[model samples]
Target: MRSLFKTVLDQTKPVVDEGPRPDDKEAGIVSDDKEAANVSSERPPSSDGDDDSINKDAQPGVQKMEAITKVWSTRDLYLAYFLIWLIYFVDAIQQGMGTILTPYVTSAFQEHSLTATIGVASGIIGGISKLPLAKLIDIWGRPQGYLLTMCCMILGLVLMAASNNVNTYAAAQIFYWVGYNGISYTTTVFIADTSALRNRGLVLAYTSSPYIVTVWITGPLAQSVLNGVGWRWGFGIFAIVTPIVCLPLYFLFAWNERKAVKQGVLVRQKSTRTAWQSINHYFWEFDIICVLLLSAGFTLFLLPFSIFSVQKYGWRDPTTISLIVVGFVLLVFSAFWEKYWAPVKFLPWELLKDRTVCGACVLAAVLFIEYYIWTSYFTSFLQVVLRLEVWQTSYIANIYSIGSCLFSIPVGLAIRHTGRFKWVALYFGVPVTILAIGLLIQFRHEGTNIGWIIFVEIIYAFAGGACVICDQVAIMAAASHQEVAVVIAIEGLFSSIGGGIGGTVAGAIWTGVFPQKLKEYLPAETQDQWATIYGDLTAQISYPVGSATHAAIVAAYDDALRNMFIAATTITIVALVAVTFWRDIKLKDFKQVKGNVI
Candidate 1:
């Protein structure tokens, strides 16, 4: 572990600045560099104080935005990291339980078919929020962002426990994900702020280590909640426990911020702009309008597919047609806005052109698309087909995350050892992903062995660990120290988008095809109950294993999952191709982004 987590301050003398050579741009390869150096060192400065970070134009929050730049002792970081991991630990259990109850929560409204739509809603909302959250932490500082996002998380959990309809549940999911992803984004930024460039991926990968411990416990924990208090309490308990766990971390950041202020390390700079001017300034700065346009466009366009299945008018559904049309228009408008008239660009044109950065972005998007497409409703499938207990189903379902978390340890070590990430991703990640998807496709058949399903999941998890850590490293590599934090915020944006699209597609398939498949597979007498079974997991799993109804339900599930896996498999192949676009940048050092007050 020590080999994996290199000492941050061990080599304090600045890394020799070997900036990318000219041909590196032409090759889209780093040459002596590893990947994306497309990032500019320019940054929006702190409006609050006279600070010495580069790019002094007045804009957002802290100078150099380095929380640890001149802050307190090594003891402070050690305590802060302890508190950070503690938050991660509670967060793991909270999020894990929340995921377990999502399907049931939707089913309470008899809208289980719309389950994926919830993810679509949440992922899109959650995904786009990362940039804004990043901007927020930039402007307001880390502790403030921490408190704000945590509040959102608690609110979402409370609402989830009390939600009575799909609408409320969906909205809660969006809020929850926004906060969830925000917390994740902030922590990653914090890690970058603290760790050296070379060790960034190593530490970032370590963040997922909690999942390794939590994975083994989440299954039994979820099962106990389900059997004892039912699913509502499952979500409710997290809301109650999370604050107790997270508030200490908040106090740590807040107190350190105060100390930094008292010590003159950070001084608040007062803005002279009027309220409206400040609003307008930030409006363009954060690129909110563009985000809204893209979010609306993406949501409207993809959402109709699933809702289309539920609407009685089908192809003639005016609402569905109108949404798709409006969505298309918005999408086009967003493209032109981004290209021509937007005040601030969300991603710079050069970065967009960088194959390494683009490759990483594309990988994030497609990986999520492939994952959400198949995994939504998977728990329901497991319980029905494999006749597994709630705990048993959870263990199987969580294999991917557990495997990824565990594998990340080695992948992190390798990056630390070789100072390279490309070969690991290209050689190990892609092949394993393909194999996992192929196995998934094979196992979706009825009467398939459950072990094969779990096997594929473990493999998928391994791929996720390898691919994810590498892509993130690739993204940050392209950034100058100045632009690194910005890149971190937007890193998961495409993933969120991909997840949203994938979930929508999943809903479309399940709602449109699963019921039909249910009709096709179920016996004549059991036919009318297909709707009931589709809406209720308990109903699906209630019948005797060998009985006609039970077999029919399992067959219907197998059929639906088959389509999902087929779609997921196709997307996985695209990810394999997409990954090739990344230059094989070796992980050598963190961006020292010149011009800061360091």
Candidate 2:
């Protein structure tokens, strides 16, 4: 299967270097002077350098600087890793807060229906932001991109803290989601830039280790804040702390950029064109139209899931039908534009022609889809079905993260030592994940043993950790340095799309099926209370342990979760199939791979 995809990609698009080849002295640098001149001419008008220097000396100087900049000392690499880890740590805390905020939103705003709607919106915004953000990172440099994301995060957090209505909160999430996705995508690019392929997997895995502390602490901390100060303070405190903690990283990046310049390892270009020309350049460069089309298409397409669920007529509603149809049309147009019409392509069709990159993306998307299907309802299952307390449910939920954190470093080190990732995906990740999901389906019934649930989660987490690291390493190993960031971003885009779709599918299933099942299971006398029971998740769990109503609700939840788990298990099997097509590319230090450095 893997060979088949490779053959097709090779025939469809010849695998040629998009940038300078290793043998070229200017390899890994920007395009040649003629190409650069053409690019500059097409840019929005900006201040330009001397024509004579650009014609004679500038290109050569730029080439020289690129070559010098490619060389990094051990200490420099360590500092870069430290910065990535630090940023990831802060991100984990923010994400943890987000996990708890759904319930808080439900309680504070008394809008239980908006919970899934907000998630879909966030996914849509985040997914759409990646395309332009990735290009901006490549064009503007990583530091500037990282700082921009931080600024957005701070702004969003402030808005969230101040928000008094659902509209304000949703608006804040749009900003925060974009910032979160941007920062994450930028960090991956940074790691790819700094780390050699041989150790890249390990570095990426280590970056996730902060989840160990953050995942555990985030729940309790958010709960405590909600119980004591208020949910508003939960957002306010992070708004204040994030900037302070992130300032050092801003300095670190600035320092690195300056050092590169001072060492003659970076050539800074001065724009000499008009402001309008500069604006035009950025528009074309970032491919804004494509971004808008894709974003609008996805947002419109996926939003109907949550919207229809909340609406009176559900999927039969005219608005829902129109959204789905129009969204599909827009997506088709965007694909057409990107493939055949766009001046600049956001999807990286060239690199994706590689079998490993394509396969890894497929696998990642499928896995994420599988993950979200079950995860979308995991907390509800624990609280409503098994009747666990918030702390207990949180502890159970953290098992996945904890398992992944514990095994990620070891899995990465193994890949680093062995230089083989495909077998890991094939032999360990696929099988373990399948087995875990299978067990989850079998055991996820009302009154199932808590121990069994924990066991399945642990196994699932470990396999997930291994698969994530392996997929990243495979993709990065297959790509050139110039393509690394975009490739990762593209992979993230796929995952986001998968997540959005998964959320929709899962939401439809739960909203459509769960209430019906509850009605069927509950006594006729209790049918009158369906609205009350379904509307308040807290109220569902608050029923007395031995009460008949509580038992009936628990049974309904178990049945609903069983169906979701079955869907998840089915989706996971596709990931296993995807793994079969993943090629095991030999990992090498990027510095040692000729023409591969940036």
Candidate 3:
């Protein structure tokens, strides 16, 4: 029966009516089956008229998308990164100047505690603000939130630029802090939205390169501007330039959002409840115990550092007890909130169960302390030890920033190809920590040159850049793809806390211990005279004073800063050992959404 059916099918097949074509006749071409099948499956090729209509209707979207994709891939997306970094660079200068000008600010304002308290407040504010904003990104959309943030930034900078009193300046810092925190958090979310997991590690690294670039630029730029123009002008120029540079990018991003929606690459949503619910659901569905343990581990680690400066007895003091108590409360709450309190927890509890997340956070917090000290004291280090003029000191400081900007892109790209950021963390972070510590030891000798400072900076900056990339990659690897934004936000939240603590602790070392060390290094009569002379440097440096005691005090201040770096390095070593225990997270591409989330 089968053979008979096949035979009938062959006979019934339409024969080719080869008219005058001898080639078609000789080939015995069957016209019916193959030609009909092809015609049925594929649309006919477009005519000229059809092509024109399609092009006319789709041209704007296609062109815009092409531009957006190009920008998204490497252009405008990075533009956001660059702008944020630039903002941070100028802000870093302002903040660094605040540190360098600490004595100046105290003298000018007639209050030392004022500057210290303000600095502490800024740190705390920057950290606390990120938590809510991270959650908001899913609801308000990144672009809109970012626009609000930039506007706040401009207002804050303007306030700072115009302020004449310490009270006014402090208020300006509040505004600046608000803007800075909001913009930073949203920009991270924007990066997560645009890049997939496969390329995200490198892309995020590229996006973050600007931070290193800005750190290099801001310090020297502020010093030169302060020396040549004035401190007021330093703030003024950034206030003017930041908006002009950042505004255009902000508008361009808005246009990109519209393009994304039109292209159907982005879905417009009226409610973000579902996304929130998604996160909360994951928490209940996963390991609640692990969340609490991880939170407790980090809180324990962070509490000692954060309050070390503000407490009366330092880390070993009785005050540490009170801070630990508060930290424990917060730690317990964080676990409970994430695991059970929310209708759905935003953080994936399973990722916290993995040793990678816990280890990365540990290393990241440690690596961040290095940056905190570097930014806080580069000016003091140069001006005091080298006895260089403000401009000369600031000029040397640029080497670190330059190293970071130059290396961020290549390092980020390299990590994408290697898929082994854990090793990058070790290679960059461990050595840099050692080099930083070594510089401190060298500073103990009176013979160390300013060139050593510059060289150490270059090494430290490269290490800092690589460490940042590794932490980011590690965070992504630990979390499921859908939780990428939350993961980044959480990491950032922890980093901000780390930076705050590092800066405060460094400040405590300088303010609390340095004066004692200075006395130990010099005789009492000379110390009293040196202290008196140091108090009036602004007036003395303005005149032609050939005082040798002035130089010694400067040297002592340099020694104090060197000690801070050494302490920072010790913290980094702890981070290094912790990272060694980190388990590698093997990430699948975003397209493979089939896997169980975390």
Check candidate 1 and list the clashing pairs: 34-585, 36-478, 37-478, 48-268, 48-269, 49-269, 197-590, 198-590, 481-593
Residues 144-228, candidate 3: write the lDDT tens digits.
5667777777787788767777778767776777677777667665554444443555555444444444554555665666567
Return the lDDT, model 2, position 66.
32
By the lDDT metric, which is better: model 2 or model 3? 2
Clashes of each: 9, 16, 5
lDDT of each: 0.74, 0.70, 0.54
The digit string of per-residue lDDT tens for model 2 on 1-598 reads 2342233223222111123224532211122344433332221111112121111222332232233234444445445556666777877877766666665566467555456566666676687677777777666667677789888988888998898888898889888888888888877776665455666677777777778777678778767876888888888888988888777766766676677668665667777979999899889878888888888888789888766766678889899999989999998999998888889877777677766778888887888777877877788778777878666777788888878876887887787687567888888997899889888887877788999999999999999998998888877766655556677888888888777777776776777777777788877777898767776777787778778888888777777778778888888788778777654454532232211221
Question: Who is ahead in lDDT, 1 or 2?
Answer: 1
**Candidate 1 per-residue lDDT over residues 47-131, each given as its tens digit:** 1222324334422343434533455556666666666777887888877877777777777788877878888878897888887
Looking at model 2, report the run of 10 residues with the lowest lDDT sum.
43-52
> TM-score per candidate, in order?
0.89, 0.86, 0.69
| Candidate 2 residue 74 C-alpha distance from true site, Å | 4.6
Top candidate when judged by lDDT against the true structure: 1
Arranged by lDDT with the best first, the candidates are 1, 2, 3
TM-score result, candidate 1:
0.89
